[model samples]
Target: MLTKKKVIISIAVLVVLMTGVMLLGNQEGAAEAENKQVTIEAVNNKVYVMVQQVNFIEKAAEIEFKASLEASEEGIVSSKVGGKVVQILFEEGEYIHQGEPLVKLEEKEAGNNLRAAESQLSAAQASLTSAEVNLESEQGNFERLKVLFDHNGIAKVELEKAEIAVKVAKANVEALKANVLTAQVNVESLTDSLAYTTISAPISGMMDEKSVSLGQNVDSGTILGKVKNISPINAVIEVKQTNLEDIKVGQKAKVTIGEREPLVYEGTLKSINGSADPSSRVFKGKIQLDNPDQALKPGSFAKAEIVNDQKVEIATVPLAALAGNEDSCYVYVNDQGIARKRSVIIGETEENVVVIKSGVQKGESVICTNVTTLQDGDVIEVVAE
Candidate 1:
């Protein structure tokens, strides 16, 4: 009975030793696997990214906006007197100069009235000459009578009658002169009416419209056509209230027209409205461009870029570096091989680059690629261009 109890106790001891050895081996295996996993993670954790150094550059700020082209000078051709359109001297799209006759009207009636006025003036002038000769004779007789009275050779009553006769002759001459002046005025008035029979251009420009045809009788103040001076045209633009302060007259601007292949024109800021438009609530701006060829037509759509004279030093980065929308923009900057996401305030965008107003310093490396996949604190390997 003693031997059987000892054998059972030895068997229990061997089984406990084997279980301890197995537990030790499993623990060693788990430690080795954990160390290998840590080494793999340390080697493959870094991401490859492209970075650009932020640069400070001096550049003039530009404002871009939509614009509409218009002629600098526009004239409305109209008639001052009613008449029949005898001859049309200019056609639509014809170039004309100031004071150039554009339409001719029948001049028979106006010519006749002018001739009558001239005849009346001639008759009145001849009558005045005869009256002046008569007054001279009367004056000579008065002088002779005065001498006779002084020498007591004539009666006082006779001398008085001679003086009164001279005075009456002078009065008659003055009345005739008044008549001559009235006739001269009439002649001048009639001459102006005769000249009005021809309609002339008020300004130098191209005729853009025609309202009267030959043989068409038009009343006074009738619109004949429209003339527009297209050289040195105006490009009108609406400026927002926020950007009003940055622009002023005399600034340089570039105007572009067409979409497929744009035509660029150099211009200057001509005017800015003092008050905002009632409907758009924006200020109207005008840019003047020299169009010697008249290639810029009126009412054409255009785009304008106004460059400010004041230059500013600003930090810039590639547009690809921006990670968020316009309202919320961010960029990843490499800080000693570690990517740190930073929120940035952006300004104007020029081509593929953007102006960084804040949150990034000059000469700092900004991650341009793999921005979306980068976290707040990411291990990064900057690659060459």
Candidate 2:
């Protein structure tokens, strides 16, 4: 009976030990599965991306706007006298200089009047010379008569008559002199009238709008043509009130024209309007460009980039790092290995880089690659470039 009781106790103890071992194994398996699941989740959540530190650079701020090219100077061509246009000296679209003759009118009537005045002046001068000679003879006669009267050789009446004759001769000579002077003035008037028959350019520039033709009649102050000085042309731009503070007179600017293989010209901000426009609330500005080649034409579309003289320190990032359109720009910045979406104010773009006006600090790591795939509070693994 004692042997049988001991065998039953031994089996019970072995069964209890086996149950404990099985329970421990099951617990270990569950722990391992939980750990594996956690590892998978961590791997799935982490994103691998390339990043670059934001750089602060000191550079001049630039503002760009669409502009129109215009002539710096313009002149209206007109005539001062009225006559029939006998000749047109220049054609439309011709380049002319100031005071260069452009048209000619009939001057036959003026020439005839001038010749008649000249003939009158010659006759008056001849009559004046004859009158002066007669006055000298009359004076001699009066002196001789006075000497005879002093010696009782001639009467006082004879002396008085001689004096009267001298006075008459002097009056005649004075009248002839007056007539000569009037004739001379008439000649000058006719000469000026003849000169007015020719019309000339008022300014040196490209001429256009030839209104008068050969045999066409024109009156004084008639619109003949227009001359526009295109060299050193002006690029007119409208600037908002907010931007006007940054721009100043004599600031450097760059102008671009055309699209396919565009042409660039360097210029300066020549002027700005004192007040803004009532309707648009913008100020008009002018950028003067030296166009010696005449490559830029007036009324052509252009773009002006004004560079401010003040240099500012600005944060910059790669173009790829930026997301969203120009209206609302944002970037993904890495904060302690986590991607944080940050909204930023966009500015001018340089080569392969963009200026960040706000929302990012210098030396902060910005995710450049895989930015679109990132979300706020995402775990990121920064990779080398």
Model 1, position 326: C-alpha lDDT score: 66
Model 1: residue 126 alpha-carbon error in angstroms:
0.9
TM-score of each: 0.66, 0.63
Off by over 4 Å in 1: 1-58, 277-280, 309-385
Tell me the spans in candidate 2 whose CA falls farther than 4 Å from its real position: 1-56, 61-70, 143-153, 235-264, 269-287, 301-310, 313-383
Candidate number with greatest TM-score: 1
Q: How much does each candidate deviate from the true structure in C-alpha RMSD?
A: 8.7, 9.1
Residue-wise lDDT of candidate 1 within 1-385, one digit each (tens)? 8999999999999889999999999999999999999999987899999999998998887888999998889999998878888998998888899999999888898899999999999999999999999999999999999999999999999999989999999999999999999999999988988898998999998898789899999888999998899898999999999998889899999998986577889999999999998999999999999999878888999999999867878899999999988678999999998999999999656799998989998778899998888898888898763
Q: On a 0 to 1 TM-score scale, where does candidate 1 land against the true structure?
A: 0.66
lDDT of 2 by residue, 248-342 (tens): 99999989888656778899999999988999899999999998877778889988999987787888899999998757889999998899999
